[model samples]
Target: MGIFRFSDMPLKKKITLIAVVSSSVSLLMACLVFILSESLTFPRVMRQNLSNLAQIIGDNSTAALSFNDSRTAQGLLDTLKANPHILSACLYDLKGQVFARYARPDAPQYWPAVVWEEKSEFSGGSVRIFQPVLSGGDRVGTLYLESDTREMQLRMMDYTLVTVVVGVLAFLISLLVASRLQQRVTGPLQQVVDRMKDIAKGEGDLTKRLEVTGKDEIGEVAEAFNTFVGKLQGVEDMKLDLISVVSHQLKTPVAEINGFIENMMMGLTGELNPKQKTYLDEMRAIGRENYRLITDLLSASKIDRGVVTVDLKPVSTKEVVGLAIRDYEVPLARKGLSLELEGVWEGGMLYADRDKLVEALRNLINNAIKCTDKGSITVRALTEGDMGVIEVADTGIGMDAETMGRLFTKNRVLGKEAHRSGAGLGLYITKNFMKQQNGDITVTSEKGRGTCFKLAVPRFKPGEGGRL
Candidate 1:
């Protein structure tokens, strides 16, 4: 129903198709030229051959015609039997009357009764010629000859058969050679495409490269690709170093600033007015947020450098949830959002890193509070099979499918409206933290409804080598 466009073909097929089509067209043209040349040249050669035979007979028949020896003229005419293409022969007197005649058994009986002129022509698939008899440089009579074009026709057929056979063999050879040679071009291109796919799928192994085997265009392309990826790798390293340095340099000052604000509120300086106290409080909050951002950056840098470690041990999920909630109690009241803890801990102890579990809980609760405006937040902890599951559900502005897909991806900020002050690294770090402890985190959300985050940690059992 529709044309198959050339662009839609794969690289290898495109190359092979080009080679095969080029060879086929060239072969076709060559065959056509050969056939056409033979078609024209073969007829001329046949006419020349017949004329030579007619000339010899006319020269020898002069004596017979001048002396009125019809018998000798008949002998000259009968000599035409040597050539199978000569269908009939005749001798005409000076008055243009037929003097002698000869015809092959299969030739037609009808012929011109008299010679018309000294000329040769082709008509009705046959050649006819009228030549003048000459003796002593004087024209005496005429010699008429007629020939079938069967010999030339047969030669043309033979040429056609040979051309067809040769064309087919050449086509096969060209196809075979092209199919093998095209790999030299498409092979490198295919390798580049595969590496690109691997990078696009987040494998991100920039160290991998195409093997350069020549100094041609393909090799140049491979060199360019390798250089580009190397530059990207360098940029990534520089970014990580910058983040690590800036965060480390800022974390201490922010913590000290928050300490000084706390001391001022406790009247380490002169007692402050209400306005001064409110300003100090605001300063403390801002300092604490700055400190949190620095901590997240440091943790992310450590994760990137593969230096983050988890101290796995038996821990109570209930204690971890209680600790995480206490940190958010002030923010929850400020926002007038309800906080409900539905965790009844009758389950087995979790085999996880206690600090990492608490940090993960705090990140989830913080995100829930940030997204939610008026609705309540619920924390549910329970045991299923050999795992302890914590569910943090919030009546907040949830995400669409497009945002949800990259929710835990590093360096991807979801939406500016949803996370106005977030660095987009909290969930990424938390997910990695859970993974380090042999646990996992999952999420579910609807665009307009709400979001639910689930964190699963393995249950601890005695005599199990302290491993999940």
Candidate 2:
């Protein structure tokens, strides 16, 4: 889990982390190899040097040992004092008796009682070497030399100190280099992310393209993204064309038909029987619903095409709400639902577009009436913080969490039953209209309880020119 999370880290951080870890591991391995090589090589070199010195001494003392002269042999042994690590030296005759010996002033005279064959052994921080004495290809005596191992210990100490210093410097250099170089890779990635965010926020500038620096992977990605956005722009153009046809070719005819139906119901045409009246009534109702759908689709398309403009000014919340509620009075009365106006007088002027505010409120009220079977609808308005708030609450069949999650999305149906009715653009349009006017809408609902939709707009300040 930890590895996966680290792998998911931002590209810049991941690059730096990889550089630092790789440098550190490489440095560690190199240091280990250096120490191991020095350890093995140092002992062999020390043993060879000691053996050469012993061979020279044995050759110099061959005549002295053959004539049994201790002074000459002792003089030859005294040369060992020149090397500080050589603590002591001894010569043993063929009879295994000590013939002549030399010891450093501070070191003890330590030797075996009998001389053995030519060999070397290291023990207790010292090395002892027994080299054979030869004359005319015959073994004469054994020269034993004991030396302290402090030189190898000091050499190792120096190597360790140098390794630590080099490791620290290397690590710092690697970190600095990695940090500087990682920007080449991460900078382009960050640009792509920022551009994607702008597009997602509905800036809708699909003409924007990423600059490609080279024929690298990042460059490839930028090119691919540009291609994708271009295709999307083409699709959006087609959608706008379709909306244009619907506006010019469809809406006018539908409105004329609805008007004719209304005229017939009002007796502008010939009178009708009971069955005919009922049929005409149902047709009018269906015609009204179809007209609403056409208008909603047009509004949604305008919002998407970024052509919807707001004439921002100071608007009276009470007046707007009254005007919007006037259209829904008959629906409320038909449903036998009560209406309550609370805090309406206290609703301060807001910086908004009057028409947009009315449209948003009407949509919310219409939804409330459709969802509600009994109880009442309440419209409230007041000031909160720097914004004026208007709330439309209804005793309706409220939504669950899952339904509310996608409620304001375009063409998202409200419930299983809603799939048979509505283009699902009501809340989506209302929300977008509020946003264009620098206002916002939110809702709160509980299943089987009720729902409340809140519209917030900037409070009107006289000197601010009604700008949000």
Candidate 3:
């Protein structure tokens, strides 16, 4: 078993522990103060009381001392029996000689001959007090009192008991209050976290809100989250609506242009000259690029609206790769760029929307073509684990750290030239399409080296999609 340290403790447990420790420390300090005050003040108070009693005794015994009567002096000192704290008492003459002494009846008479001291003090858990006896307003004798401190011990014990009770009560009360306080602070934050997770997991509902319990910091956090999500929802909605309208409008023109170019290439109206045919082919390429862009934009709009219609079917990885090569071969050949085919996709059956996956593959290829200028591009498809992986690698001008970091961010393209010439939505749309179809895309690149984009989708099993 691993040892549990305070750093590894969970939040609520940490909260509870802090409260308990604080209460314990406060109680411990109070206990120390009480003990210290008693240690000093208790002895002083006992000494003062003993000194007063001894003075009264000496005053009453003044005549006895003057008449040289031991019996009367002893009787005056014996009155100390009334105080349980007074262990023993002694009467002395003006010459400082012991005249009489008294002790508790049951207590051993351990009285020793004493000399006069100028101070009242505590020793051996007891206090000694001394007073002067007088006759005819002249110093006649001195009387001394010894206190046992048993009564003081009893009183201190009672004080200690009360302090312990209060400390325990304080600790228990703090735990309850602290637990409640911790709940109040963490509750709304937890709700915000759960709600954000729900949206990320595809619920995507921005209307849900955290209840505002107060106008404190926690409530402010909830309010900030709601406002931020509201803004994000607005932006996303506007983006999709604009894309849908623009793409739909552009699709018609691209279709018409492609139709006219195909007709000219097919010689539907009349035979064309060689130079005219070549220019028509170039126009066809341009038309195809436009058509593909419009299609991607429309698909992205559908995807953003969460209204994408996916038709997952068994499709061979080789066939998909072939389609991608066919799409890019003309452009690559024009640029004198070589396209290499690598490792066969043996367990080739993959479940995906054939058109959508093809579009994603094409974007990766096109993106590579944009970044890479001279070197060959490599296309590889292979089965790894439970997924089929398609890799499009380019040996061209690689990307910098900043470009790579924001590569798939919405409306952020890799290169400034590409941003000016093209909409910066290809990689972002490609990633979204892959995610909606339960796939993933990853990119690895190094500056001045090359870039590789990988698309991993689940391999199809027999009858995986049933009918649809």
**Predicted model with the maximum lDDT:** 2
TM-score of 3: 0.60
Model 1 local distance difference test score: 0.86
Candidate whose TM-score is highest: 1
TM-score of each: 0.77, 0.71, 0.60
The lDDT for every candidate, in the order shown, is 0.86, 0.87, 0.80
Which 10 successive residues of model 3 have the least lDDT summed? 413-422
Q: Write the per-residue lDDT of candidate 2 for residues 1-468, one digit (tens) a residue.
A: 344687678888889889988998999899989999999998888888889999999999999999999899999998888899999899999988999998998988677765578888888888889988999998889899888899999999999999999999989998899999899999998888899899998764787799987788999989999999999899987987798678667788999999999999998888888998999999998998898898888888888788899988887888888788886777789999998999997777888899889989988888888888899999999888988899999988898988989888875766774343568888999999999977899999988789999999888988656553
Error of 3 at 466 (Å): 6.1
Clashing residue pairs, backbone N/CA/C < 3 A, model 3:
none
Name the better of 1 and 2 by TM-score.
1
Question: What residue pairs clash in candidate 1, if any at all?
Answer: none
List where candidate 2 sits over 4 angstroms from the true fold: 1-44, 51-69, 75-99, 102-215, 313-319, 342-351, 381-389, 417-420, 458-468
lDDT of 3 by residue, 1-468 (tens): 588998998677788889889878988898979887986788778777777777778888988899889898888777778777788888888787888999988776866555566457678887777777777788777777888888789989888888889888988889989889888777777787788788787555776677877898878888888888888789878978998999999999899989999999999969999999999998998898788778877876886687877788888888787777675767788788898888744537788888878888888888778777798999888877888899999997777778878887665645654453456778888888788778999888887789899998888888645322
Off by over 4 Å in 3: 1-68, 75-183, 186-228, 257-291, 342-347, 400-406, 417-421, 463-468
**Model 1: runs farther than 4 Å from truth?**
1-25, 44-87, 91-109, 112-124, 129-144, 154-184, 190-205, 211-214, 384-386
